[model samples]
Target: MRIQLDDLQGPEIHALLEEHMRGMHALSPPESVHALDLDGLRQPNVRFWTAWDGADLLGCGALKQLDAEHAEIKSMRTAEQHLRKGVARALLAHIVEQAQALGLRRLSLETGPVPGFAAAHRLYQAFGFQECGPFADYKLDPHSVFMTRLL
Candidate 1:
């Protein structure tokens, strides 16, 4: 599969992001939901990418600049049919490589704490992310789990 920068304008990507948002909302409370929407992902400091196998969308992920030396992972989601197929792992690896290329020293992310998010937590842990307090504009939230890693 190939991972490429996306413009967030394609129907497939739009649908995937919508599914991500829906899943996030269902897993956490409205106020605890931090997943970026389509417009939010279009911000200047955020870079979005989509993983594809030929014409099929496999997954998507994004990196958001929090400061000169810190970056946040955002909008990570694998297409339903692509689960357990290494799509998320490849997309996350690509995001980390991009962050390192940009000279970011730290990478952070926030995800829900429910069992529904166990696989994601495991994935992050495998990539060296550890639990931490909220960063950026985030505050202490029961439904939210914050994690970070030094690159």
Candidate 2:
């Protein structure tokens, strides 16, 4: 699988982002969720990517530059059909590598706060993320579990 920079207009990437937003909205209340939509993600600070197997998009992730030394993970999602196939793991590892390569000393993220997100939380923990305060432009929200890792 190849992970490459994504154009926000890419169909598969757009669909995956929409699916992630839908999943978040369905699982959590609107007021509690703060996922970036297409417009939000297309901002100058974010660098997005997608993992592809030939013509198929398996997963996607993004790193939003908070500053020269800090970044935030965003829009991480595995296709429903590709769940449990290590797609998300691969994408996540790619994100970490990119963060390190960019000389970002810290990486932060926001996820859900329920068992439904247990696997994701486990994945982040395994990658060295620890519970942390809200970073960048985020606010403290019980619905959002924030984490950070020093690279």
Candidate 3:
């Protein structure tokens, strides 16, 4: 799969992100749903990417710079038809590599604690992310699970 910087304008990506938002809201309470919409992901501090095989969009992920040395992972989602196909893994590995290339010292993320998010938790843990307290504008909440890793 080819992972490339995304401009967030394609219909395919828009549909995928909308699906991601719906899934997030379905799994977690409104207050605990931290997933970024298209506008949020388009912010200057955020860099987004999409993985594709020819015309098929496999997955996407983003990194939002919180500071010169810290960044937060956002909007990670694998297309429903592409789950368990390493699409997320490829996007995540690409994001981490890009973060390191940017000279960022840490990478963090917030995800839901429900069974629906089990695969995500395992994926992050396998990538060396460990549970941590809230960071950035986040507050401690039972519906959220925070994880971070030093670059």
For every model shown, what is its TM-score relative to the native structure?
A: 0.99, 0.96, 0.99
Clashing pairs in 1: none
Write the residue-wise lDDT of candidate 2 on 2-116 in tens digits: 9899888877788888899899998788987778889888999999999889999898899999999999999898989889988889999999999999999999999989887
Error of 1 at 68 (Å): 0.5
Candidate that would win on lDDT:
3
What C-alpha lDDT, on a 0 to 100 scale, does residue 46 get in candidate 1? 98
Per-residue error for 105 in candidate 3, Å, reads: 0.5
Return whichever of 2 and 3 wins on lDDT: 3
Local lDDT at 92 for model 2: 95
Q: Which stretches of candidate 1 lie above 4 Å from their native place?
A: none
> Which ranges in model 3 have alpha carbons more than 4 Å from their true place?
none
| Residue-wise C-alpha lDDT for candidate 1, range 51-101, written one tens digit per residue | 999999999999999999999999999999999999999999999999999
Candidate 3, residues 1-151, lDDT tens digits: the string is 9999999999999999999999998998898899998899999999999999999999999999999999999999999999999999999999999999999999999999999999999999999999999999999999999999999
Residue 52 miss distance in model 2 (angstroms): 0.9
Worst 10 residues of 3 by lDDT: 29-38
